[model samples]
Target: MKPIVTIAETTQPDGTVLALQEHDGRRFLLSDNVQIASPATKVSERELARIACAPFRPIRQPRIWVTGLALGELLEGLAESVPQKRATFYVAEPSDELADWHREFYPEGTFATDKRVFRVHGVDTGALNSLDSPLHGILLHADTAPLHPRGRGFFEDRRWLSVAYDTLQEGGLLAVASSRRVPKMDRNLENAGFEVAYHEIDAIPNARRPKTHHLWLARKGDYTSHAH
Candidate 1:
């Protein structure tokens, strides 16, 4: 196995250095206290497979928006599973170096090169405003506010939540995953006018071990809220 090499560094709130590492060929973000971010290789491809294949009833090819492009695994999985020729993907990320690293290190056939995929902005996700047109689906994989520090600012701001709500079309979906269980996540989605469903992805058979993740699928229209 090749030794891990440090690529770029960022500072955490506790005055700790967050290091981006490349081991063999895989990249990861680690801090002194914990692993900040990493590629989702541990989770079985089946879990992502289900998400990618989730039924979507779009009038035309749906316009999808994704925040936190990470290593592009989710994007790649989604592109492979969903074959809407008229689809468009809008991606947002905070780090330019991470984006460059993704383009350089990831495989050539990955989702980054897809013509429909667009790198829209390089800014903190908390500052993300409303989308110009309603989106068919919004995928958030970066961080969950109140559940994770990276997303704390977003959870604290109701305005941001409202922006997300307004960006989706009726019957649109907002799918998110968090490392830790967020009991209030469903309620928060309900408060934002979405019908929420929460499930543990790793609970399924043949799922990845030591890779606990919570999947929240929220819809914009008529369904009843599962939160209580």
Candidate 2:
């Protein structure tokens, strides 16, 4: 069997170690010896982005905000689905080191050099508040959201959800992906004045241990008539 080699590492403020490892040409990030990020889910993450942006296909220059830049899979997906030259993607990632790591190590994708992608080194609420115009979509993955740091997260906070709800255009969407279903999160989205829809996706279609991920699509307006 081949060995997993750690190509790079970063130490968190709380003394946790984050190591970037490669095994058989596949790269992954591990936090304190537990896998935190991997390209294994790239297909699912891309699909999540594609589904999230389905409502904006008819709109010109649709603006999207992504809560995190874990490996840039979501950004790649967005770039693929939204091909308009004027489209914009605002990526909010609190950790600067993560961005640096991607730049230094994972430089294969155009997401790193994509002119439409804007990097915001901060939290989701702050990034959303700083936007001059409302976004067409807000993308977030529950496990990779930048708001979590050993406590209650921005995704879980009602105030933040309200901000997200208000930051979006009338027919905009708030798409959230999670490894498991959390009923409270669904309720929270509904309580935040969004029309919520749930979807179950296969993260890995033919793997030995098939994994399912949940996606919640919340809309700000009565745009269900235009849903794709």
Cα lDDT of candidate 2 equals: 0.81
The reply for model 1, stretches above 4 Å from the true place, is: 7-19, 31-34, 39-49, 57-59, 107-111, 122-130, 142-156, 203-211, 222-228
TM-score of 2: 0.91
TM-score to native of every candidate shown: 0.75, 0.91
lDDT of model 2, residue 171: 79
lDDT value, residue 7 of candidate 1: 79
Candidate that scores best on TM-score: 2
Worst 10 residues of 2 by lDDT: 144-153
lDDT of 1 by residue, 193-223 (tens): 8888877766334645556677778788842
What C-alpha lDDT, on a 0 to 100 scale, does residue 51 get in candidate 2?
Answer: 94
Per-model C-alpha RMSD: 5.1, 2.4
Q: Please, what are the lDDT tens digits per residue for candidate 2 over residues 55-98?
A: 78777789899888877788888888888898889889776788
